[model samples]
Target: MIRRPVLLRAARPVALTLLVLFGTGTGTIDLWAQPVQKPLTKQAQTELDTIGAELRANARKREQKHQSARQIAEEMERLRTQMIDIARTQGASEKRAAIYRSRLETLTLLEADMTRRLGTLRNKQSRLLSALQIYSRNPPPTIFVSTRKANDAVIAAIILKEITPELKKRAAVLSEQNRDLIRVRREAALQNEALFISESDVSEQQKQLETLMADRAALEDQLLREADAIEARNLELEARQRTLLGLPSPLRAPQGRALDLQLPVVGEKAGSYGESIDGQTNRGLRLKTAPGAQVRSPGNGRVEYAGPLEGYGQVVILDVGGDYRIVMTGLGRVYVDPNRTVAKGEPLGRTPNLTDKPTIFYMELRKGENPVNPASGFDLTKL
Candidate 1:
């Protein structure tokens, strides 16, 4: 367990409830993306500069030190809290997209489940009808049989009388299940309609959001300091990685004991840092993100390398501070140039569009030359 970290110490318990009630038909909510470009107030600009300076300083630190887990968690939590404050409401576009994508996914899964249940009900009904068919095909022997068999006929009649109520009960159950089949069909159709609408909305919104993000990035660029030297080093690392087909060593820095990214993309929980999945041990935290989802930097850092490599798609490596680096993979686009200093919540790129599965964002943290549990940097033991 980790000691109380900064963000967790200040955070309160939150309870979330998810309700999936289906309607007979689809519904629509008119939505629009009109990001107004506002000039940063003087105070905002000052805050940005402060954050940038901290990132730059962290990137240059060369001190080497060892600390207990508590010390590391505390330090990482402090930086995480700062970068989160930098995020603000600047992610309006991506935030909307995530909401829609989540809705579409929920509907898709719900339809699949309903379809499975409907099939099971149909099969059960067929088996039950077959079992009752013999009774249905013949009536009990008439009571007007020969004298020797008259008693047997009477007994059979009595038995049928006793079982009549049970048969009716079974009939009622079958009727309800038929209604259920109908309802499931209606819900499935509703979901399909909703899914189509949501997909279209997402595609349109992605285009507009990309444009909005570019404008914001352009404005912020003019206010930030230039990093020519850092860029040069990144280019060299990029070259080496291509030649050797391996990750480059961390450029000297993170004087701080703990490290973490707030999480670049908002996505569904995939796995923890050390969990074993399939047959391999997971080395990083992975999040399942939707196609065209925007990925932002989780904390203050410098882009050590950005772009595609052989096995990995478009990737970004950030040198946060003191022998520390953050590597992200499975991105479709990389917007930031390598070696550029970025504050928390800056858009890094977009995930590729895929048909079979949602994009899985893979993130890992390294200290010097070894991979470590990324969760160790967070102070989440409290709440």
Candidate 2:
């Protein structure tokens, strides 16, 4: 007997608990407020700004990497189809061989570049880890002695000690940077491997056509299927790697209900549920955010739909679990694809920066086909 896949079940008690915990007298939850940070010195503030910039850059890079990989896979599929057509008609011409060789060379160059980048990222990671380990073992030396006996050397030492915390903070930031770099590198390497395999298959097909005089239609169909299978395998492998790196995996069993979900983007509330817009009642919460603000996933889920809709500019529909889905719309660009699993806090896209108009994001939570108030299940009052 074949065992059927288990469907996710809802934890109604947890959902009710969330409703009680986040409900305000006004019947809405605010998720944008964050704890105030202590004032920092000018230098410390500058360092923090630098770190923030680096993190944003890393996020951009990771998104770009995924986009590039997707493009390459699509190109490979297109080329495979073209090869099939050519095999059916021209029967392995010199031009076909040349095209195959050219593509292989391009893939080789891309693999080399990714290898170099990975090496550099790993080196930086090693250095940062070593520094963090040393700092952990040897705490900053104390310089304060008796105030009466303090001299110029003592004062200098005290000043150095004061800088120790900042140094440690920098090290910690570097460590996080390394982790991001490493993730991107791993993704790049996977793409390179996929490309390499595609090139190898093309080369093998070419050789068979030249020497073995294989049946054109039969060989083409077999290779095309193999290419499709390889692409699917690559996607599965990449998904697994992402899961190992702490991101969500669609294949993994749901652990528990995600009752307390955060807002996908940080912004001021613009519209509320039950509000009328264009003769229709609004079924979700809306926010006005700065142009080009990054939008993130509010909960761990597989992307069921990620593309432009008739009314919404760009939309991402995530199936959280137990028939619960989250819909986010009004994006300028989408970073993820349909069927990809996304973790909570993972970047999904960016809001458009329109100079003349405010960038508005619309979000909704649903159980099956029925729309529900997002606040009913999520505590969005605090980050």
Candidate 3:
């Protein structure tokens, strides 16, 4: 009887644990293993079982919905990656188009330059032909023709008097040896024609050579322009890359840095700085003066661009320190060699005639890449 009580006490705790485990996922197995007993009302047990079955179904549905949502999210992520790749491809195409457009512009300029040079060559050839014709027609005026019959007869008589009677009688036999001067002159005219043909052929050949040279020169200029554009593009791309990589911008010289052109005799302001009288915007400040007037360098540095440039006539570009450049234009002739270093107020060359309208000295100053108007930069005290 005591053993029975002890066993019942242990069985009570085991029963509670089985009830807790059944309430979780082991409910079906527990129900099958346990003996059927009418401890609670049959209606209440049936209702509890039905609610557990409904709960299990709802959990399974929720799991399915969660899995579907995860798959959709993964697909959306993949599409977003593809879109980014497409955008990058579009950007690359745009850059290529821009480069091609620049190249086309450069090619157009080259063609125009070549056309101008060819026209110049043709004009030179025409002038040469005219000069050759004038030379051939006015042959030195030194060859004199005598038309005095007395002189001719006297010359013939002298010859007869000097000769013996037998020789004089043989004169008729020698008469057949006399040559025709008209025939000689005709041959000379033919020679002149041959020379003209030769000279014309040479001139044409020279013109052809000049055309070839101009073509090559234009090609070179185009190449240089293209190279510069490419370099600029590369620089821009690099700058963008640096920005993307979170780098600081490169330092450059400040704009409108004051420069000194150590000239001693600063000429007067022959003309006020403004647009041309025609209202066209002037590229630089023009100081009107006579030809052969001394031009002073505006700044001290090595000369960069020193030659005959279009529109500006003769120009000398000086490279001042700190990325400053000074352009002195409208020169009559360049007296200094390129790459020569000069001080401010240094004599450059004589001022050239500005198409006979005015003898002007055009000056401009640049700091770094920005242009500072000469009117604003230079001291106009000496003008």
Candidate 4:
């Protein structure tokens, strides 16, 4: 009898801790005091089986799309190589050269369109990957629910009666999250595969275009006799080549001082340069702000990098001319793509929504990979 009272006293603290964690009332203590087992009914089993089948089917569909994208990318690469080879061998025939040029022009446009599509897929994949990581770190408890009311009654008597309502709610939320994670994982895998294939396709096309340009330059020197005519034709070809290749003009320094530039995002500085986070010294300033807050470009520049980065959810690196580069990270979504130009104050991306944690945006200025204080260039009062 004395031992019984001692055990009850010891169990009280444990029960109370659980109640605090789960936010359950005193009435829930008795229900959750003992372990219980309940077998799922036939209808409930059938429903879960159906759900599993649907998930598999969706994964297969995504796989098919991935394969299709890969095939198309391969075909694009082959066509580009064929066009370049034809242009080099048949340059003497004006009709053949014209045909090859037209095909090349079409291919260039198609490549750009495909690149944009791939970028979208990459962004989606990044978001899904972030969610997956979060779920993996803090997994929810599992609880089985029955679909048939009669079976549910039996299950409830055996198990549900022994589980707190708060815990049941948590279990349900976790179950839904698991389903979402499965779907997102399959989709992200397909997107990544498609992106890899498209990148290879674009690289090959660019190489072929460069080769064709070189061939044209050589042929011009061999065929043309008049120096003046040859120079003029070469200049025209050079201009056409630059346009077709989408090469940027020579980099020039900005007119105003760097300090006059606007702030990238509207937020208070959380950490300054030289401050250590997780034992690593910060090379830039961390800005704390609301979730989904818009991140903007501090000055006119081109996007150099935009995608998922380790430790950072999504990152965007912008080239602002004169060897100056801006690095922004901890974004939820990116609005720009590499090689795309942006004006000052243009939207670059948004900070991720971390419900239980504060959203922080990290920004750094660099001159050839050497970190510099961004505050030296921006108005401190505004940020």
RMSD to truth, every model: 27.2, 38.0, 35.9, 45.4
Identify the leading candidate in terms of TM-score: 2
lDDT of 2 by residue, 221-310 (tens): 343334334434434533432332233443332234356576887677777788988898999988886544568898888999998999
Q: In model 1, what lDDT does residue 209 have?
A: 51
Clash statistics: count for each candidate: 5, 3, 8, 1
lDDT of 1 by residue, 125-188 (tens): 5675565576557655656567757776567568767866876776687577667657656765
lDDT string, candidate 4, 1-383, tens digits: 00111122223332333432444443332322322223334554454344334434443453343344334334445555777675564434444445545555554565555556555655665565566467557544334433565464566445634544644565565555555555555555554455455445545655776676456433332222132233334334334322332334323434445645677765777888888989999999888865445678999999999999898779999998888898889886687888999999887876653242447888898878899876666555433
**Residue pairs that clash (backbone atoms under 3 angstroms), model 1:** 253-321, 253-322, 253-323, 254-321, 254-322
TM-score of each: 0.33, 0.35, 0.31, 0.33
C-alpha local distance difference test of each model: 0.55, 0.59, 0.50, 0.57
Weakest ten-residue segment in model 4 by summed lDDT: 1-10
Model 2 worst lDDT window (10 residues) = 1-10
The candidate that wins on lDDT is: 2
How much is the lDDT of residue 113 in candidate 2?
67
Residue 357 accuracy (lDDT) in model 4 = 41
Model 1 worst lDDT window (10 residues):
12-21
For model 4, the superposed segments whose C-alpha errors exceed 4 Å read: 1-259, 354-357
lDDT score, residue 354, model 2?
A: 31
Looking at model 1, residue 241 earns an lDDT score of 25
lDDT of 3 by residue, 326-355 (tens): 777767657678899987667676553223
Ranking 3 against 4 by lDDT, winner: 4
